[model samples]
Target: MTRGVRGATTVENNEAGEIIEHTRTLVLEMAEKNNIKPEDVSHAFISVTKDVDAAFPAKALREINGWKYVPVMCMQEIAVPGSLPKCIRIMMVVNTDKQQTEVEHTFQREAVKLRPDLLEDVQKDQQK
Candidate 1:
């Protein structure tokens, strides 16, 4: 079955380095928590808030080892009023044998506030 593993993280600035580094961290954690290998990934859809135009989040995904050929896309996230800024979000879809509830989704930095429920799941999983 194919599952979508979600992740989001925030950067302190709009600089390319900051964006890329934070995005890399979020992607890596999402992959690790879900046990997703590059070969298992079908594609990744990444979006950055309007304030983060300094870099393409997809660049970070491609930079990962063995991920060069994986399909990916980048776009600007809808600018909702009062929404979080400097946020990069990713939906990594991959084929896996694990049940849907077994999949792990990660939210890092300030993005953790975006989904406290999922963060709670992560915390519970960490105790296991």
Candidate 2:
């Protein structure tokens, strides 16, 4: 089976370093918590809000030790009114035996408010 792990995190600023660091951290945590190896991932989609134009968050994925060959793409998110700003979102499709409900979706920083129902999932990952 294939599972999709979703995550979103916010950057304090639109600086390249901040975007890179937060993007790396969020994706790493998402992969770790779900035990999704780079080879297991079919592909990933990353999107940042329009306000974030500092850098491509996909750079962080390519930097991961084993993700060099993994397919990744980045683009700007839909600019919905009142939507979260300075946010980056990642969706990864990984080959896993885990059921969809068992997959963990992570929300970090202010992005936590975007998915309060998944707060417990985020808390579990944080405890590790």
> Which has the greatest lDDT?
2
RMSD of each: 1.1, 2.6
Q: What lDDT score belongs to each candidate, Candidate 1 first?
A: 0.89, 0.90
Tell me which residue pairs clash in candidate 1. none
Clashes of 2: 0
Q: Model 2 misses residue 45 by how many Å?
A: 0.3
In model 2, the runs with Cα more than 4 Å from the true position are: 121-128
lDDT of 1 by residue, 1-128 (tens): 99989899999989998888998888888888888889999999999899999888888878988889999999989999999988999998899998887888888899989989877876898899
**Residue 20 of model 1, lDDT score:** 85
TM-score of each: 0.95, 0.92
